[model samples]
Target: MPGKTKRSGDLATALAALAGLSYLPPVAAAPLTFASPPAEIAKAVLDDEPGTVAVGIWRNQQGRFALQRNPVGSVGEVVEDDSAHAQPLFEIGSISKVFTGLLLAQAVERGDLSLDDTLGKLLEAKATLKPETAAITLRQLVTHSACLPREPQDFPGYGTPNPFSRHDRWKIYAGLSGMTLEHAPPCGAAYSNLGMGLVGQLLSDHYAKPWDVLVRENITGPLGMRDTMQYLGRQASRLATGYQHEALQGPWDFDALSGAGALRSTAPDLLLLARALMAGRAGPLGPAAERALTPLGYFRGDEIGYAILIRGPAGHRTYHHDGLTGGYRTLLAFAPDTQEAVAILASNSHASPVKVLTGITASRYPIAPATQMAPAPAALAEYGGVYQADKDTSFTFVAQDGKLYRRSTGTGFRALSPGGPDTFVDADAGARYVFSREAGEIVRVDYYLGDSGFGGFSSFSGVAGLRTKEAAPPVAVVSLDTQLDYAGHYRARRIIRTDLDLDVRAENGQLGVRAGNWFRRPVFPVAGKPDRFAYENGRSQLQFERDAAGHVAGVVLYENGVIRLRRLP
Candidate 1:
């Protein structure tokens, strides 16, 4: 009788608490003079958003200025009041890849490794890498051209709410042993955490030490980045608690993949590194650091010269990297030509620090805006369709009022103005979209962000990947008895280090799924498909599997890849 109308009391209470509570306002803090360009930018960011604790550092030929506000919160406590020099530890995330990239350059200078060295030569004995993987060079890995998936196949099955917590060295090697290249080496740039993780692992093995040791002895140590490290260790008290939508989130830990996004640092330390890079000082790794800043080639339509992203032409360019973890967001960017740099570290996961960094950079270096024009109605209609890059990522173009709008699950819709035939520009964000046609039919789309559309852009091809807006038939009402039968506990088929269990329950005549204690959401039955259910706000689907006796035995999750979960007795 409770099947169709009952709700979980705990879930209801949690949701209520989440909705009722408001984020704490920024505490009264330091007064920053808006005299300098960086100071003005910092004030604008703080004034625009309340309850945001941010630290920004600007260094130019004139001098250095740092700005801060409020106190950094961790878990539920405010650890330290923010100051221009407050050394509150913040997770650097993917920026760790930039450090690893510098390490590779250092290795090359020491004659310890070469960018041309093959993966087979470095990791042959540790894991049974695919033949194609063996042929991938270190340069390809650092530039994200090794064609590796963003994460390993079993990454989801790891089960921990914090995915990287238990993905240790052995598991990493195991994943590599079974990996099959989806595309050949030097396949147009696809950002890959796996590839960067491999760079750290190979460097550690070659040095006969741990990755943390290698980073400290070479990159951070030489640059005088005392607070930067893979682990907080004794400095845990200085670490800020990360927050997501006002909910407390745990800090991320790394095993083998620590090289991907494992370092915690302070704004001052990042500024120190940036200053050294801009000065091109002669230190132990200084020459190598300069080399790492060189542009390797075009990636996703941007320059990929080393481990970090490079933008603009040769003489005028910005070399930078951005990082995101559960509760932290960071931006480290600098322009070499103007001797200016911006480093922003924030405690809120949803915060967009890059926008602030961009503001600072744009003020220093002006970018020409793209000219906009009204496109014909037929042109707008031709590009209107749903295009998907992967199972979990997609874009939809719609024609409304003679203008083409682009939509995604993450960001809603933004109207695009035509810059040229089959080319559109988003003036506010400085993004450009160019459509490719074959025999007068729209076949592909390319998207470029920043740089006023001077570099390469990521391409999405194939007409078969398009989705239509046509309405579907009404879903048949599933029997209450059948819905009850689907209730059970399920676990991933692959044995993982952490728990990956799915609990299904029939509540209020609908099916609800909870993965461990992290994700709990309702699922709806698909029209004309009795065994399929949609979840994750329709970004993912689950297909129930049956045993020989016609009883539910398991489920297949369809997202970026297929994951099998067996029904547990």
Candidate 2:
């Protein structure tokens, strides 16, 4: 029952407090003026596309404009957002990692923790860690090239609706410690949520304090970021309501992984921090700020490069991070060279403030095309239908009330609109997903996030591989007899050997199976396919093998590899 609901009670408390509170009246004064912003910049901000909410520009500590604008709407929609008074205290997610990095840099400055220290050395001799991961260094974690897998093989508490709960954090870490490494650390760059969370743990150990408290004392408290909180708690009133598409959605609180993406702050507070970072002599980070943003390595993209905690794009190098929770999207960007920063927070999960924010740095902000023509309903309808790349991988495009929606097998579809016959716009970010057809049939799907291109997918013609299929209806629907025989922990011995477990139960006409340490998803049987059943962690796949007697015997779990389990009591 607890797992079924995603909304946090803490978030609700925060909202209740915010309900009666009101901001001071706006100054009847003109907009804060220091210098003339580019005319094109103003137009891009004003002509905000659909799915966008708040847009602000701060240049050289002089010109600042806080404009409330809605995507694809009249001035009233913009006015409703109240950009002038829209307190931007939303969870900025991984952007909080940058703050954690600053704390680490400060620690190194004080001779408390060194960047060169390996993870094994940081932990007390009593704390257990896998032998392979002992070589993982703090430096590798910062650069995101630790080659650490993104999550523990058996981690289940991840992606919960109310991810900030105490139940999620302790359960997830306990599960992770029991797991094995997918690759050795420092082998190559692998973006990992687990690796970042471990950094928080290490920092906590080094300071002999809690991770959240350490962050507050070293960074947030010093920067005067009163609104940022790792847990939603009773402070939700100042937080903006998060939305999925257009409807209000539940909140996300990363309690255990606070170092990875747990802090929430307003735009003004973020800009204040950015201004300090640019000044290079602010609070706890004074004189040691340069070490935090130095280039570590290339990012996972083509256009820009990554340096440890810093991301360099084109002419400017910035300390940046963006967050993507279910119904909320947040962005924070600051030019390390110019001391100019822009924070865009959108309540709508479909909203994309990144394009508008990044354009300021690139000098090519997106403007609505002057010539606009609505596509014919019939024309848009033709793009609808399922498209397959392989038997194992397929995408579907369904036409809903004249608008097109796209989805993959295990993922949900978001509404998309037309830009051209071959191109369609992502309703959220205004990015393009282009299609190329062969003999009037789509063959390739290419995605572009602004000017940066995301590679395309092509159909793999007639390759021999296991194809997913729905099993036919069972001839005999009988309850499973082996209940007590199958109850207990089963370790994944081959691939990860993550000491994961499975619990079995017989109820009402069928067998129910629950697996994983933290997050438990229901495992349903494959109809008429003997012991085979569908198991979905993040992605779903068929599992279980039958013995010669047609009884469930060796269990083969497929997730990047085949993990077998011999039944144990």
Best by TM-score: 1
lDDT of 2 at 359: 42
What tens digits encode model 2's per-residue C-alpha lDDT throughout 126-158?
A: 346686666777878776767675554443432
TM-score of each: 0.69, 0.54
Q: In candidate 1, how many Å is residue 550 off?
A: 49
- Model 1 scores a C-alpha lDDT of 0.64
* Candidate 1: residue pairs that collide: 4-508, 4-509, 5-508, 73-241, 74-241, 295-305, 296-305, 301-456, 301-457
Runs of candidate 1 exceeding 4 Å displacement? 1-52, 62-84, 156-159, 281-284, 357-373, 387-394, 437-439, 450-569
Q: Where's the lowest-lDDT run of ten residues in candidate 1?
A: 19-28
Give me candidate 1's TM-score against the actual structure.
Answer: 0.69
